[model samples]
Every structure is written in structure tokens, then in C-alpha cells.
Target: MELRQLHYFVKVAKKEHVTQAAEELHVAQSAVSRQIHQLEEELGVKLFVQKGRNLQLTPVGQLFLKRVEVILADLERSVIEIHEFLDPEKGEIRLGFPHSLGISLIPQVVAAFRKQHPNVKFRFKQGMYPTLIRDMIKGDIDLAFISPFPDEHEFVCGEVLLTEELYAILPPGHRFSEEESIKLRELEDETFVLFSEGYSLRPIVWEACQEAGFTPKIGFEGEETDTIRGLVAAGMGVSLLPEMALHYTGPLQPAKVRVTEPQVTRTIGLIRRTNEKLPLVAKVFHAFLLRYFQERIQESQ
Candidate 1:
């Protein structure tokens, strides 16, 4: 039976009067009656009977009413869920970022976005660049803050949010600690604390060292930038890190020396799946981040 017929049947079942049901449904009485009759014919069951001046439901009619209620309720709920999904102001966003940005940038941006769109919720995934890119491609994350941008064609990159210079973090009493700016080649002989494989910064630093004429002599390997910084502070080795790493180094701040000869830096931007359009919430957040960074750039200038 058609949904219209089921709707008419439900109204009639609820009111127990065709005239009142039609009036409430804003349809003609004969139209409502015809729909109910068609539904009963299709089901091969009588749905109503006369009880003096009023109409009453038959036994089968009561059973059908219960099932119809559930079906109609589920349909209504589905419509509401679709509307919420399309709503820009009310939805969830799955966001991904590297552990370095997670220390400050991600939290600040999320807080600012929530201040205006309080109904929007966020699911955060913190990982290195490779992991974030992998998750984005797999549809596990909606959007991410990624550095140096993804080279694959499966992802689309947005405008640069931030460009941070790479610094050589040295121990407190190291020879290079007193220099105003150090060249990458100068650290060729020194032990280095490098990020583990799969981290985006490792390649950027490695390439810079290669251009400077020698590969870095790696002393230790760690995942998070903060841990690498800690290693530097403990005299384990020197490391190349983005400026953002310095902000969260706490009391054990390593000596930060700007890399000059080939001045290395990393550009961070938003990235998402190229195949699918972003959800309304993710689109809004993407725009919000672009605008936020643009304003920061203007203020800095």
C-alpha cells in the first residue's frame, strides 16, 4: 500500500471518525475514506466497524495500527537525521592534525569555532602527517591540518594556514648554542635526534641536510616533537623542529638556533578527500580556518 494510504489509515485509526480525521488532515472526507478503503482492500482486512454513533477498530486493525505507528515514527526520525546532517550549524566534524599542532593550534582554532557555532561538535585525531593523510584517504577523517601538503592526487589542499621556519635545537652548553644563526652544514658532525619514519618533518629536514652536503648523524629517534626537544635538552643530540615546538617545551627549553644557509620552513594547510564533497559542517570549518589564518597573516604584516 502507498504511504499516503497508510497515513490516512493512521489518522482514521487515531480519531475513530472519518470526518474528524479528514478535517485534521486537511483533506476531504471522501478522499480520506477512499484512501482507507484502498489500504484495507490491499491488506485484505477490515479496519473499522460501526459501534453505535461512533466507529471502532477491528482486532486486525489494532494490530496494524501498532506496526504503522512504528513505521511512521522511524520515517519521521530519518527525515530529521538527514536535515541535521545537512545543517551547517548543527553537526559533527572529524578533524585530524599532527601532534605538534595539537599542542596549541588545533585547540585554539576549535575553541574559536565553537564560540560562534556552539552546536557544532568535534572529534579530534592526533597523529603524524603520514597517518593523518592515510586516515583522510580512508574516510576516517573529514579534514586535517597537514604540512608540506599531500603530493597524492586523491586529496585537495587548501590555502596555507601557517608557514613556520625550522630551527636547530641544541643543548645548553653546546658550541653552536651561542651563535645568532647556524648553517645546516655546521651540524653535519654532531649527533642528531630525529623524528621516526613516516613523520613529514623528517624528510624535509633530511633533504635540507642533503643539500647542505652531508646526511645528519642520527643519535636517537622519537615520534613527538616535544620528546625530540627533551632529548636535545638532555644533551642526547641536536634536532630540527618547527617553531611551534618551542611554544610547548615547558621548563626544559632547548637552545633554538635558526637554520640559515638554505633557510628551511614548512607550510601547513588544510586537506580533505578529493573524491567527495565535504559535509556542511566540515565545509564551514574549512572556511573558518582559512579566514582565521588570513587575519593572522594580515596582523603580522
Candidate 2:
């Protein structure tokens, strides 16, 4: 049977009335009936039987209906994917990022790429590091921006785009705030404002504090980088934060001092499924991101 025949069968099965199905399919009722008749003849089965004014699928017809729907749906997806492959600038990208990059890095990259391919679209998913990686593996997101970039696993791979030094965020009038750069050990006595445990930044800060010979005394725990910064700026405590997270916090930003001794840093990078054959728009953004940071790093150097 032809593809149209299968399409007509599914429509007729759902609608249960030949006239209504024909009208919805924009075809004459006689044509729909003829196609349905031909499909039944080819398979040597009475696929539908009339009951009063409506049609109902026979036992085998009900089974065929389920498989035919799947086939048609898969065909439609293939058609759309090829269309995107032919003109990728008009395609869409499903992307993932952590909260840290949302305000600073993500917008800058997407805005720059869209200026060149205005028809390209983006759908973003924001979560913690492991969650984003799981999204890539499950194909929920074609790519992700992860910091302290992960090592490649059997299913996922990452590429470091840029490495930025982690800085200590101290209260504005705190003694260390006036110093140009200070050692991590110097803040051993201070209460620390930090991201909660699940956040990637939380472990980074903890590890640095551990290496510095002190376990940070907790003052307040928060999820958003802005919340952590705001608390510290209000003289609640101190914390370590990545450079990107520092850029977009507004006037309430705490005083930032570079960490000198036992200097720490985070690598902001992209992650994708190891086997993913990314859609054209996603590949375009991926390349743009890598080049964007490379150029920025070179300029700074």
C-alpha cells in the first residue's frame, strides 16, 4: 500500500467516519473510500467494517493501525531532519547550561551567533553539572556548557573552551578585601556563604578550603551565584566563585580578590553525547562557542 493509503487508514480509524476523515484530509469521500478499499485488497483483509454511520477497525486492522502510526511519525521526523540538514541556519538547537553561565557567558554566545544566523532558534535547559550531563546522554539537550569540565566517559565527551581563575569574594569592608591578592588560608576563621552541596561550585569551594587547612564555617547556604554574592556583600561571610559568575552580579557584588597561594580555577566547556551526530544548528553554535572563547583568550593575552 502507498504511504497515503496508510495515512488515510490512520485518519479513518481515529475519526471513525469516512466523510469526516475525507474532509479533514482535504480529499473527496469517494477517493478516501477507494484508497481504503485498495489497501484492504492488497492485504486480503477486511480492515474496517461499517457500524451504523461510523467505521470501526477489525482485529487485525487495529494491530496494523498502531504500527502504521509509528512508521508515519518516523517518516515525518526524517523529512524534517533532512530539511534542516539542507538549510541549517533555519534550524533549532536544544542547549543546556548551568545557572552560573546564564547571565554572563550564555547570552553573549547565543546573541553573537544569532546575529549571523537570525533564523536559528534556541531552547535552553539549566541545571547542576551532573544533571546537564545526563540530559546530553539522554538526547534531551544536544549540547551543554559545564564548568570544571568533565572527563570523557563511554557515553559523553567534553571540550574545554576557557579556563578562568577562581577568586575569593569577601565582604566590602572585610580586612582581606583591601588586599590586592591573598592566600586561601588567610580566611580560615571567616564564616563562608556558599552554594549548596549539589552545585558544582560548592565542591570547588570546599576542596579549596580543605587544602587551605580549614573547614569553612557555614553562615548561609544558597543556590544562585547572585544570592551567594549578595550575602557576602552584606557582610554575612566569604566564598570562592568562578570568574564568569562574578561578571554579571549587579551593584551588590562583593569585593573580589584573586586567590594567590594554592591558586584554583575552573574550565568552562561544552559537553555532548559521545555518539551524537548533532543537528546542523547545534554544530554551528558549538564551533562558534569554541572560537568565541579562543579569540577572547588571545585578546586578553
Candidate 3:
């Protein structure tokens, strides 16, 4: 009939004596008996047989006891999970990262986070800023590592994690490949291999070229970084990529030269849905990214 009734029933079933069950439960014997009786009436089953003050569980009572034990165990586990999720030291956190950041910054932060909170698990998805924002709005992602200046007011964004400088990946024999750094104007006549429109770098690279007083002459477009690199390595065309792409150890081999004209940089940040209650894990990750990026900024200085 109620939680108390179920507790009394379980206690009596365990001890097989109303007096002992009541004492163990810190309740009076008559109260336990009355509650058990009420539970029996509610369930339309006689849960106990009495013989000279000795209580014995009936067949139905034994079957029901198993189910009740399972339910109580689940309730206890649910409470524990809720508390650990709030504590940040345990439970699961789902976060998103842009493709480049996922390869560079995120792994370092995740390693540090895991060292401190081994019980916590992370589910990471790779996406561009727009897709990341969409997932955050749908509550499919808790937070995201986003590129420079997320413009939408519908989400909260933290300080920059790192600044990604654009670079031109030149084939082995290009004239400026040996230069320290090349200006965007140097690529005005060069064919450009670029990623698809959804990639965060696409807009930045395009804008950087426009700032140099010319539009990009796109020769090839692909989704995967590896594919784009392959195209460049085969001498299909030169491409503008984030500094992080130089770290790629894939088959593509291209000379990386920094972009000096207008000196473009994309500041990355942690983004979350505005006005939503963030879980403790997400909050911890957000703080971690800010600290990590600040240290990087200091080191570069």
C-alpha cells in the first residue's frame, strides 16, 4: 500500500518474526503488523502464514519478495548515480569538439580530467561550430569546444581555449614553400584545395583571402582532413589549413607556411546552451579548458 508497508513486509519476510522485524526496523510490533496487513489487503494476497507467533512467508510472498528486492536495489543505485553526477567525480559527460581541436587540445584536457576523476566517463563527438551548436540546442551535447566568437546569443560561451593560426600547405616544389612564412597574396594565383562548407576553417580561410584583396580560387573540395591532405600531396592544389593540421601524420606531406597578411587567428571556446542547468562534469570541463588555454597563451608570450 505504501513504502512503509513494503519495508515492513520485507523486514518480516527476512526475520520471519514480527517482534524481531519491528525491533530491527525501529518500529512497534503492532504497527508493523497493521501495515503488513494493509499491504496484503491492497494486493489481495495473504503474504504471511502465522503459527504460534512465528511468521512464515507464503509462496506468493516469496515471489513478491524477489521483485521488491530488485526494485529497492534499483532505487538505491539511482540515488547514488544522481549524487555522483552532481558531484562531478563520477558519472558520464557528453561533450563535442571541432575536428582540429579534437586532435590537439581535447586529448590533453581529457587526460588530466581522467587522472583526477577516474570514475567519470566521457562521450566525445566531432563537429563544426554550427553542428555543435545545433546538438547543444537539442540537448544531445552538453558542451562544445567552438571556434572564435560564437555569435549566437542562445548559448553561453567561455574564453578562448587556443588561437589557431591559418597556414598554407604547399607542395614539395613550390617557390615560397621554403620561405619562413608567406602572405595570403602569394596564393592569389594558386589553386586552393579546401574542405566542405560545413567545416569551421572554410569561412576563416575564405575571409583571410578576401582580406588579402582576392577571392579564393577553389580547385577541389572534400570533407575529411586526410582526403584534403591527399589532394594537396598529389599536387592537385595548395590549401589553407589550421596550424593543427600540420600535426597530422597521414600520408599527405606538404610544406606548411604561416599566413602573415592580416595575421588571422581563430579563438576557440567552450559553448553550452544558455539558461540550462549545466551538470557538474560539464562545468568542470569548461573551467579546465579555460585554464588550459590561458596557460598556452602565456607560454606563447
Candidate 4:
């Protein structure tokens, strides 16, 4: 079957109406119908069947569609890869990061990078710890800034950029708010709010509490840092947040106290596919990232 037939078939499968598919394809209805018919005949299988007013894929048709989607996606990626190779600086970088980093770090980092490579573009995706790793392995993202990193992965390689400590977030006027640092166990009796299970920070907080000889009584779970911070600010509960999340200023702010007893910390890292080389633009950004964080680390020292 021709590429056009596969395209038409996928469009029809998605729309479930040949007329709509034709409109989207910007082709005549007859042409779309003819190609779908030709594709089925060539494969010796009925790819689609008529429903009440819509179309549906047959069992074999569903199987074929999966393979066709992969083929088409790979073809599209190849075209983009060629274009990127021709003009790396103007190409796009598909980057992924955890939800916690999105609030401030990602925007600041992108803004700083753009100053040096103004022509380059970026497509951002927010994922949890596992999702970010899986995305890089599947070739969906060129690079990612992952946390609790320096994590040993056979399919990806990376370096630790920042090893920032976690702080106990307390509501205003709490007894511990006046302290610069508090032990993990000191908050064990307090109601705790923390990032939900998927986040890398969650486990760090949990284990630190565990080591402190207590199981934290989680009163609320949040998917974002700001949500947890707001909950803490409202006296919903106390939370342990990374150093980066505490630097920003906002109205719903909670007091940040360092966790010194157990010293909760997470590593922020830059990771990429071990077997696949990054696009030219991504490579340049990767280098810049190393230097940027390096400078920050040095300045902090």
C-alpha cells in the first residue's frame, strides 16, 4: 500500500468517518475511499467496516494500524532529523523534566539558554520520575533534567548537577518556624503533606522520616510542589521540599527550615540516551547546561 493509503486509513480510523477524514486530509471523499479500498484489497483483509454512521477498524485492521503508526512516526522523525542536521542551531530540542522543576527551574534554565542560542527552539514535556526515564529510552525526548539522579541506568547516562537538600516547610507562626534547621523526627508528630508516590522527592522525604525512627503521618498528597507548599501554608500539614522549590517568592509561601539531622537531599541531573546521539542543538544545550550548573556550584562555593 502507498504512504497516502496509510495516511488516509489512520485519519479515517481516528475520525471514524470517511468524509471527515477526507476533509482533514484535504482530499476528495472519493480519493480517500478508493485508497482505503485499495489498501484492504492489497492486504487481502478488510481493514474497516461500516458502523451505524461511522466506520470501525476490523481486528486485523487494528493490528495493521499499530504497525503503520510506528512506520509513519519513524519516517517523520527521520525527516526532522535531516532538517536538524542541516541547521542544528535553528532546530528543536525535546526536553523533559519532573513536575517539581517546572515551577521555576525549567523556565529560568530555558530563558538563560535562549540568550546564547536564540534561534534554537524547545518542546517541553513534564513527566514523573519513571515517565521521564521511559520517554528518553523510547527516543521521545532528546534530553531530560531528572532528579535523585546520578541514578544508575543501563540505557541512559548522566551526571549530577546539583545536590540540594530538602527543607521542612511549615506554616506561618509555627513553633519551629524560627529555627534555621530542624531534625526529621522533630516533625514526625506533626501532620505531613508530601509529593505523591511517583515523584522522586516523595521517597526521599519518606525514607528520611523512616530513618528518623518514625513513619510520617501523611495528611495530604500533592502532585505539584506549589500545591504541597500551599497546603503547608494553609496549615494543612508540614512538608519536606527541595532547595530549588523554596527559592521562589509567592503569596502562598511556607516557611523553609533545613533538615539537618538526617540531611535529606536529591540530585538534579542531565540525562540522555546512552546509545543514541543527541541532535546538534541538544548537544550544544547539554554542554551549556553542564557549564551553567558548574558556574552556579562554583559561585555557591
Candidate 5:
């Protein structure tokens, strides 16, 4: 089968619905079906079994998928290498970052990159960690900045960019506001404001609270860090936030105090799929971010 046929087949396998796959591929459903059929015929096996409207991969299809995935990844890597050699500074780098980091870090990295490689373009998105990880695995995003590592076995390469201590964002007049740092155990009775589910920091907060001997009383759930801060400032609840998060000004100016009873820290990192080869532009950007952060860390001391 041709490489186009493999591409069509993989897309169908990913969606498990020909119509949906076709839409994602921006091609006609019939065209996708035809190519998948051609691939199956050429391979002398049934790749998918139709049950009502849903498609299921056959055993042979599953095995073929593994091989197809590797072949396609290698081919794509070669294409990236060739394209970069031909036009070093021109191409797209799709990246995702959590809102907290996106506000300041992304702009700095992008500015630095542009100063060196003006022709490069970036497609940036602010998303929760779960959504970012899903997009990265699907080959939709080249890189992501997320807190606390996920299963490292699944990704090809990743490096922790920065480690920041977690602190409680309290109302301006809260009892503990005057304290520089308070232990996690001291907040057992305090109402908590936090990011909604799917946020990378959620697990960190939960785990820290559990270690402190009580499940937090979640009073408010928000999508953005600033919103959480607003909730805390309004005395709706308190939140655990990263130190670096305080760098960005939010709508509400909550007290940024340290968590002391049992201090917790979160490491934010950049991750890419392990099996896929990163393009030259992505590699350069990754290196640049590391260097930039390293310099900042050194300068602080």
C-alpha cells in the first residue's frame, strides 16, 4: 500500500469512525473508506470490522498499526529534517502551556526565539494539562509546558524546566496572611479554591492535602489561575499556587504566602512523544527555553 493509504488508515484507526476521521483529515468520507479498503486488500487481511456505525480494529489490524506507526513516524522525521535544511527559520511549531506559565514565559521565549530566527512561526494555545497531553500524544502539539510529570514511559523526551514551591493564596486579612509560610496541616479547616479537574496542579494539591492528614474542603473550582486568585481574594476560599504564578498580575491581589507545615513543590517541564523525532525548530526552541531559565536561576543567586 502507498504511504497515503497508510496515513488514511491510521487516521481512521485513531477516530474509529470513518466520518469523523474524514473530517479531521479534511477529505471525503468515501475517499478515506476507499483508501482503507485498498490498504486492507493490498495487505491481504481485514483491518477493520464494522459493527453498526462503529469500526473495530481486527487483530491483524492492531499488529499492522504498530508497524505503520513506526514507519510513518520515521518518514515524518526525515521530512522535518529535510524541510529544516532547506528553510531553517520557516515552519510551524505548535506549543501548549498552562495559563499561569503562558502569560509571561511564552512571550519571553517567543521574543528570544524571534530575535534569533525571525522567520519561524508559532501556533500557541493555553490549555489544561490533560488537554495538552492529549494533543501532544495525537501529534497535534509539538511541545507543552505542564506541571508535575505524567507517566514518563509514554513520552520520548522531557526535561524539567523549573521547580517552584507551592504556596497558599489567602485573603488580604486572613489570620495566616501575616505569616511568611504556613504548614499544609494548619489549613485542614480552611475552605479551598482550586483549579477544576484536568489541571496538572490538581493532583499535586490533592496529594499534599492528603499527606497533611485531611482532604481539603473545596469551596470553588475555577478554570484559570487568576480566577482562583480572585475567589481567594474575595474570601470565597484559599488556593495553593506556584511561586512563579505570582509573577503575573491577576484581577485579584491575594496575599501570596508560603506553605510551611509540609512544604510541597511542583516541577514544570516540557514534554514530547518519545517515539517521534522532534523537528529542528522545536529542538532549538526547547534548548533556548532551557538556557533562558538556567540563566534566570543563576542570576537570582
Candidate 6:
């Protein structure tokens, strides 16, 4: 029968009196008696027997009561879990970012957010901008920190978190290392160390070189920004990297010089799937990130 019918049966069986069960349920005695009768008729079993002025549960009634109790308990627990899933203060955020950005930015933001919302936890996925965008479109990740700001219509970008100037990383004692600023065209003849395919920064650097009237002569390729910097330090070749790349703590710190001819820069923005409503937790974290970046920008100025 209906769940309400099962509920009435359990209450009446517990109190052993329809009138008292009705009082506890805040309903009329006849209402309770009528529902109990319908339950018995539906189940085709006599659930109660008249014992003096009080009612006594039959053997069948006792068995049914146990099953009904378990059902009601499970339903209550399910409702609680559903509410917790929607609770903003106590939910998980699925965050994505490029390996280059994650080196310093993600750790600082996550730590600051956790201090105020300790109950909130995060599932982090690291990938290049292309991979992160694909995952966002598939609904696999809630939000991402993307560079060169995605142009696809499937994603919405927030305010630029930061814009970093591109720098020329040169080996120690190289001819260009003596200059405060170098033109992109000046490195046309020199070999270049660049990021592997699928990284967003690679295209930005390549385009800048092309705009400067020469395609870079790629001599080596690497994945991590730190590794590329190390390669340049070992005199492998020169590379154009974001200003943030300089924060990498390593013994082999390549000399960094500003790129001036075209003045190349990359903008990073927060992104999410277009037209999809974020979960309460993700929405809260998104707002937090905007504020976090704004504060950092102000402090830097």
C-alpha cells in the first residue's frame, strides 16, 4: 500500500491503541482506524485483536511493524543526505587548473578558503587548458583556472585573475642575458626550448614569435615550466615563459628578461560551463576566488 498507510500501521502497533496513536499523529481516532483497516484489507491479514478495552497486535502485525520501521528509518536517512549534498557550508568542490598555475596560485587559494570553511573539501584535477576545457564541457569538473582565456562558446569566463608578462629565459652568459629587455625577433636565430604540444602557453609563445617576423627554431620540448627553465639554465636554448614561472624554486634559475617588441602577456580567468547552474558549494568557492584574486591584485598595486 502507500507509505502513509505503512506509517499509520507502525504507530498504531506501537501504541496498541488507535485513539492514542491518533493523538500522537495529530489526527482523528477514526482517521487512524480507517487507515489501519485499509492497510489490513490491502495486505489481507488481521493485524490487531481486541483485548479488553485495549488492542493487542497479532503475530502478523508484529512482523509487519519491524519491516515498516526499517523502511521509515531508511527514508529519513535519505532525506538527510540529500539536504547535506545541497548544503553550501558542507560540500565538495571539483576544481581544475593547469600544472603551471597550480605551482603557486591553487595552493594559496585553497589554503585561504579552508581556513574559514574547514568543513569544505576539494577534489583537484591538474591538466593543460585544453584538457580542463574538455572536462568542464563534459561536466566532469566544476570550475577551472584557464590561461589565454578560452574562446569556445561552451564556457563562460570571469574577470581576469591576473595578467602576467612573458619573459625571455636565457642561459647564463648568453649574449641577450646582458639586456634588460629583449625583442622576440632577436632570438630568431637562437634555438628555443618550448612547452610540449597541448599546453596553452606554447601557442601564445609561438604566435608572438611569428608576429615578430620569424617562426621559432624549436630545439627542445618539455612538459613542466620548471623543467623548461632548467633546460634553458643548462644552456639547452632560450624560451618565453610567463612571469609567474619565475617563482619556481630551483638551483638552476635561468636569467629572465622582459619581452618588449610586441610586449606579450597572457591573461588567466576563472571559467565554468555556460548556462549550467553551479552547485551551492561551487558557487560559493567561485565567489571566494574572485575576491581572493581581487585582494591580491590590490595588494600588488
Poorest stretch of ten by lDDT in candidate 3: 72-81
Q: Each model's TM-score?
A: 0.70, 0.73, 0.69, 0.84, 0.78, 0.70
Candidate 4 residue-wise lDDT, 9-91, digit = tens: 99999999999999999999999999999998899989999999999999998999888887876776687678888987788
For model 2, where is the 10-residue window of minimal lDDT?
72-81
How much does each candidate deviate from the true structure in C-alpha RMSD? Answer: 16.0, 9.4, 15.3, 3.5, 3.7, 17.1
Clashes of each: 0, 0, 0, 0, 6, 0
Clashing pairs in model 1, backbone N/Cα/C closer than 3 A: none
lDDT of 6 by residue, 44-133 (tens): 999999998788989998888767776775675355346557775787788999888877878889999999899887889999877887
| Per-residue C-alpha lDDT of model 5 across residues 189-274, encoded as one tens digit per residue | 99999888888888899999999899999989988777887788899988898876777565668898888757888888888888
Clashing pairs in 4: none
**Residue 102: error of model 6 in Å?**
1.2
After the best TM-score superposition of candidate 2, give how far the Cα of residue 270 lies from its true spot, in angstroms: 0.6
**Runs of candidate 1 exceeding 4 Å displacement:** 1-87
Poorly placed runs, candidate 6 (over 4 Å): 1-87, 155-157
User: 2 or 4, which is superior by TM-score?
Assistant: 4
Which candidate number maximizes lDDT?
4
Which stretches of candidate 5 lie above 4 Å from their native place?
Answer: 91-100, 123-146, 149-159, 171-173, 177-180, 195-199, 210-213, 220-227, 230-235, 246-253, 270-278
**How big is the positional error of residue 105 in model 4, measured in Å on the Cα after superposition?**
1.4
lDDT of each: 0.85, 0.87, 0.79, 0.88, 0.84, 0.85
Q: RMSD (Cα, Å) of candidate 4? A: 3.5
Q: Higher TM-score: candidate 5 or 6?
A: 5
lDDT of 2: 0.87
Error of 6 at 79 (Å): 11
List model 1 lDDT by residue over 173-192, tens digit each. Answer: 89989888988999999999
lDDT of 5: 0.84
Q: List the residue pairs that clash in candidate 2.
A: none
List, residue by residue over 1-301, the lDDT tens digit for candidate 2.
7999999999999999999999999999999999999999999999999899999999999999878876875675465468687998778788899999997788988899889999987889999988997777656677899887887578888688888789999988789888889999999999999899889888888888899888999989999988998899889999988887788546776999999778988888888878657776788788888888889989999
Q: Single out the weakest 10-residue window by summed lDDT for candidate 1.
A: 73-82
